[model samples]
Target: MESVVGNGCFRLVREMANIQGRDVFVADLYVTPTWLDPGNTDPLLHFPKDADQKDALIIPLWIPGHFLLSVMRPLQKEIFFLDSLYFRRADGFSSQAYRELLRGLAQQIVAGAWTEKTALDLKDVPKQTHGNDCGVFMIMYAWYFAMDACFDFGVDDMCLLRRWWCIVLLENFGLEGYGRKFAHFTDEGKATLRDNVPPVFRITRKRKLESPMVSEDLIQYPSLQPV
Candidate 1:
């Protein structure tokens, strides 16, 4: 099985846009190489100059194939590392390495060597039951964080949550009828429907009234004057 999930970071970007009600700036997946790369600070510098003014920076990280999310709160000077697997190991881009890297970047961005390192918080965010669901959990984390909501769902809910995501996406793009059409189907059924439908017919149709082919004079009607 391919380790990388669909759309990678773009999925998180879309969810952020939907929940934050504003455009979210996301760095390319290539920004940070493997989490183990010592030169990971370069990606932090690549953030937009005005990134500090935004609510937070949502970063999608790839450990070779597995996925995770890193959220940086500039104003708060805090960085949160959310991993669905949460493996307890000391090596290979463990939480400590990320914390140190974030601290260095924080100091560099502030332009003050004396500036305190940003706080690093390792959250007990939701975990995935299956190996393949890390990407889904990453998306859920971004969605909940963007909306300032709690991560209340778990792995068992992922199957249904995936379908709900499609519905939300369609509704957001003004395809309510299509969203409703698939609302009652199972996720697999919805996927089959989506696969079979052509892109041109996915949108709802608008009524087009044909223009009158004959001149108004040809029509019999009561005269404007007294009949």
Candidate 2:
């Protein structure tokens, strides 16, 4: 942090602090299809720099009107699937290209999470009866699979689940002061380069976290040279 005294990165320090021991790469919703797009310039999915210790990789996929969840445990050579409507995916959606996309995702994950690949084992999960609850099932699957939690939810829990989600969303977004910006730098009275703090303060940020962050930690984020 001293190297970046007045530059930005204080929040990176805090978020890094929060995730120090936790490890899971939760891909953005609906990103599974991009793996098969050879013409797509997007880079292959990567594990976090500190992904030496990972629990699982969670991905939510939307095929046609339905959404399902896929969790990859690369170390175990296992890819688990949870679909609300367990029937084979509808016509065009079940094309060979789509199957290849999922396989590509599994291959990338296994290669990144581990060193080699074998015949990955596909595991089935409890299915939802309602057609519209695929979104909800997907979310829960990600939650459970990430934590290695059990499949305790079923159709009887649907009503309570929907209402619970409603309350959670409202409480998350409807309340005032719901989202607070990171204020460590501001608290340090060093919000900008113009408000520079002493080197000790910046260096102390790393020291307090008890984690040595080398230049590689911020490879994508070039550190600003101290003026």
Alpha carbon lDDT of each predicted model: 0.58, 0.49
Best by lDDT: 1
Q: TM-score of model 1 relative to the true fold?
A: 0.56
**Per-residue lDDT of model 2, residues 1-227, tens digit only:** 02121011222222333344435666554345454465443424444653324566665565566665555676676665556655455421223554455566566545543332211222345566554666666666666666565668877677787686555444333445221212332333223344554332223344455677678765797679999
Model 2 residue pairs with clashes = none
Question: Which stretches of candidate 2 lie above 4 Å from their native place?
Answer: 1-22, 33-52, 87-98, 112-124, 179-227
In candidate 2, position 133 carries an lDDT of 69
- Scored by lDDT, model 1 comes in at 0.58
Q: Model 1, range 73-142, lDDT digits (tens) per residue?
A: 6666665677776644332233566556666666654544332221123344566657587777767776
Best model number under TM-score:
1
lDDT of 2: 0.49
